[model samples]
Target chain A: MTGELAIKNLHVQIEGKEIIRGLDLYVKQGEIHAIMGPNGSGKSTLALTLMGHPKYQVTQGTISYKGQDLLALSPDERARAGLFLAFQYPFEVSGVPLSRFLLQAVKARAPETKAQSNGRPVRRPLGQFRKLLHEKMEILKVDKSFAGRYLNEGFSGGEKKRVEVLQMLVLQPEIAILDETDSGLDIDSVKIVAQGVNSLRGPEFGALVITHYQRILNYLKPDFVHVMVKGRLVKSGGSELAEELEERGYDWILQEVGAASTESAEEKGADPDERS
Target chain B: MSDHEEHLGERKSQGVAIAEKPQREGFERDYNKYDFRDPEQYAFKAEKGISRELVEKISAMKGEPRWMLEKRLEGLEIFLSKPTPTWGGDLSELNYDEMCYYIKPTGEESRSWDEVPDKIKETFDKLGIPEAERKFLAGAGAQYESEAVYHNLKEEWAKQGVIFMDSDSGLQQYPEVFQKYWGTVIPAADNKFAALNTAFWSGGSFVYIPEGVEVNIPLQAYFRINAENMGQFERTLIIADKGSKVHYLEGCTAPTYSSRSLHSGVIELIVNEGAQMRYTTIQNWSTNMYNLVTQRALVYQDASMEWVDANLGSHLTMKYPSVYLLGKGARGEILSVAYAGAGQHQDTGGKAIHAAPYTTSRITSKSISKDGGRASYRGLVKVVQGATGVKSNVMCDALLLDERSRSDTYPYIEVDEDSATIGHEATVGKVGEDQIFYLMSRGLSESEALSMIVLGFMEPFTRELPMEYAIEFNRLIQLEMSGSVG
Candidate 1:
């Protein structure tokens, strides 16, 4: 029941409305899992809940990361523990520079990497940080001038998503949840983003790519595919499952769930509107 | 003038009270060392309340001419007749009967730093005046309490026929030029505060730049308030003669106090034909002071004037520096920035009046409010009936750091001429949770993000300041932001 990022019977509510009802998901290390669902299926809720957004209340759930209770930690603490979320809609900060924000984030991730001076935090020695940032930026195909601009302010849709992937790459988190990152990108940008996400595939990094379409899955080739309907995972399979859903739609999955409930209901499976 | 140019160490050897004192050891620019407090120390202080008797006594104390005394009496009558302003911040807390109109800290005004008392010199030193003058040094003036403790112009400028001295000395030494333009720019009945300042004004700079002369370095003035309840009313007048140019910088700092103080100053500037003048003020008053200052300038044909005003600290400040473009091809610009934090209210803006054809003006106002503070921008632009081809633009941007903070904008534009072009844009925004989340996800706390945003909001104003002042302005904003957020 427990894995790298294990969620058991997770129930999340926002403003007295239950968004994620009894959803369970498990993503182990070094594996990429795809959560594909239609709109309002609570796909983004799972992403936000896992990262500990204050607005998302986990009424009944247990989320553990590396055998530690992840639900109790703050967002930043969770991030420091190697958890990242590539936001669906990244916010903009008009005044802060991108390079400065990254340097601080990098310092937060690995405080020991920064060289200290006489009893003070010596800002990570700009030359070294800039070199490392330039390397990561080049790997992601980001413009060098992006570091000088304000964070996410006046950035194009693709540019914003690219910057998110770039942040995940620079932070090098143990696990990353990309919530609908491919929703607002073109075909070429999706492949490029998938390529950027794929480059981080190794024995140490894990990712959960939350998307509405299986187009990005073609490039990512996720090890596992999940269909979340009405706040619960209805079915899950290999990458071929993504191709099948790409051909068909959620109506077939709802009919199958209806037949299964008519015969005998699964206690863990969420009934679409039975509770209401 | 030569007496003030002596070395400070030699001045110490002259058996002066300050000469015997030693320099502070290991001075590391500790800004929190505002620990010097004199509960009640004054050689001469006028009693509380302003009356005809008080005005006559002040004029007699200075031994002024009959005409000047009569002018002070007329100013006092006008001040008593006008009511307190009800449009801006609250004025009900002001108790004029308990406030001291004048408090002379030292026995006499001194042109030399060595002749200044140790208490006043130490105050200016803590505020970083001596080192500032040494670094810049076109000229420097220092005022403590109700008197100009020290005034000095560099020999290079003093020999170039540049007149820079205290206003009181200016009135006595150069009567012809000083009398011609004393009340010409801003009359006594301009406002209630201006009328009050005209009656009790003391210890401000008087600068007159000659024709075709350009002062490369800025002339600096420093003002400090030492005792409580000392209603500081300094009057500054600057005149740039025809075809001249000058830049003036003034900085003010006061010790924090539990009791309230009042600072009402009047500044009038005259820019003659083809002249240019820029006056920059960085007012860092203590939180217990109510700074109500009136500053204006009159621009002649082919002239330009600029007001760079930055207000960082005050309990309630109501200042609207104005410019009157009275000649063809005259231009004016006012860049005003203010910050209000923790029980403070900064009601400040700018005004431009076009009275001639082909005149142009611009007003850029920026304000930040935090921790229950309130900042408002009240501006006005007017064009006369025959003042054709006039163009004016007013822009105000206010940032609130917390939900409890408040901001307001009031802009008035009147164009009697059909050929006038006027534009205004106003915006108010709070520190949203989205902004905080964005920065925090990047590992910054809430206050650090707010500080950077505040600095960016005031970038236009900060960039106009000299490099040193701009850096200091950013630091001050950082300090205020730390206290207000996160």
Candidate 2:
């Protein structure tokens, strides 16, 4: 398997407050990687920083996508570069319809063709694209009337999350990062949204599913699970580590890391040559 | 000491670039000292203030009907008793007695442009009035002072039961219908300026479209104030009968005068059921003039009313065109753009009152200010108690070109019904220097980039104008930005 998304020594901050300190992670193609952490453990910060959000300041880091630097691009450029972030809260741009926005986004991502029809240049028509979109919406069980309405204006919580999944399915990016797509969904909606995400799993795509509970992990089985604590990753393991954390919680990991640091400090005085 | 009174042609003949010409310090008097010399010209015009005597005299001079004179007298009393409005733009400097209420060129109305006097024709030629009318307009009414001397419309439009003529001629020809709907949509006492217009209004457009007729071409009226200290009050009335449509455009300009002149006009539109009416104006009055106008419309069932207004010049302006939705399924739209420069204050917006069910309205306003000027948006959206299922949206965006400029949004939204939905959005920001620098880096001059950006900001408004008016609007904005640089 090859690495679809990679981050090395990622250091992120928000207004001089360091959030993600010296973090490294990777997810391969056709695999799901779940990151679990406590409340202030930089889970959402990492997700947004990877998507190139303007508010997240990356003080020191290098994010590479297929052997190319990802930090040197705008948000829209990043999205066009096959990176998608299912925002925990999507922005509502009133008066701009969803269908119109998608059309513009599709055109922005396509290269200009040199062929002309009659005296005008011809591209893929929007009508055909809309038909394909309607089929995707049917699979996701979304209301057909939402196409004409403003994007994210007056949408319910569950409906907004479903729309995010639908956007991921339509854009079909190389990498998808879900901040918290299941935070506000009901039992049935959780299943339907999970099905929508699983439909996008293939050899051409990879997904980073950020979650806080093992309930969603019952549906999405990640190949690797990483534990993040206090802005740094302390442990990495296979699928069993998720079950251990779910059963015993993070108390043991915190106690073990604290004792290890104190023991190393005392041993430094006894063996100065070994420390140097 | 503004130079709004400088004649570009005169300065150009003297081998001077008018944009870079120097001005005398502390100049306070009007530069036009030469009075009318024609032997047939009157020594003095009518009185400066409003009176029944002055109204009656104007009607008699036009050979108007008895009913028309009676309406003028009624409007005269309304003008006399009404007080100046204390709202909107500044009005502390307007003096009624200091203005010359009327001025007529020393000739009868001429149908041919070549027959007009050279001095009067020179001004029209400099303004490019005749060429634009001949090439692009369906009809053109060129008013030199207080009276229109040339009025003509295409024969094809006249054959389709579309009547386009001066208001004075409309009164003589269609007396019964003209008297019925005149001042009905917007009454004489609607505002002080409207009352003043009714009392002393001289030259304006009067258009009537018969049922099932649609004139695709736009009719235009060009008003030029040549005389010094003259007040030009033009009254316009448009009535679109069932299933008819028309687009009317009007433009104005004046030479710079030291002493301020006054412009008060009234516009009343009656859009019948299943009809559409569009009214556009690009008023570039000299910076020494005060432009105060009252315009309104009454839209019937399934009818539509659109007002595209652009005010680029004037020291002080207080004008808000309104629409009253009187029947179900009626629609109203207003796209207005205003620019205020030094010593200018533009207080302009729109009002939409929904009185019937299923009514809809949209208002988009864009304003730009620079050189310590102020631009204010004062709008209103009112939905009555029984007007259910009404939808309204208002967006106002103002751009300040410098730190000294100011922009304000004072919107009044009153919804008495539960089923009505309304949304209002406003944004105020200064020009980003990075945007200017980026455009300048591409080999374009700074002024050209600024002009292009300003035009793009007003694209939503200018795209609604007719071809000729849109071209003229671009030219006017280019002229206004000649030397406006930081």
DockQ of each: 0.30, 0.02
Q: Which runs of model 2 end up more than 4 angstroms from their true locations?
A: A1-4, A28-30, A111-124, A259-276, B1-87, B90-172, B179-205, B209-235, B240-265, B270-292, B298-317, B323-346, B350-375, B379-486
The worst-scoring run of ten residues by lDDT in candidate 2 chain B lies at: B21-30
Give the per-residue lDDT of model 2 (tens digit) for B1-486: 001111212333354211211111201111222112223244337766656677788888889888778777877787778666545565666787777676554433213444333443443343455554421111112343323332334567667888877787788899898888988877776666776777777777788999989987676564322221123777788999999988887764322222336888888899999999999987766566688888888999999999999887666777777889999999999888888777667878888989999999999999998766678787888899999999999999998988876777667788999999999999986656544432332222456546655765676777787665665666556545655211
TM-score of each: 0.79, 0.58
What are the per-residue Cα lDDT tens digits for candidate 1 across B1-486? Answer: 001111322433354222111111211112123222334445677888878888888788777888888788888888889777645667777887888887665532213434333443444433444454421211112333323333334566777788887787788898888788887777888777778888887768789999989887787664322221123888888999998999998873333222337888888999998999999988866566788888889999999999999887767888888889999989999999888766677878888989999999999999888766778787779899999999999999898877877788767677899999998999887767666665555555567667766776787777788887776667667656775211
State the DockQ, from 0 to 1, for candidate 2.
0.02
DockQ computed for model 1 against the true two-chain complex using alpha carbons: 0.30
Predicted candidate 2 versus true structure: per-residue lDDT over A16-87, tens digit per residue: 777788999887678788888665667777887887756678999789887768898655566666777776
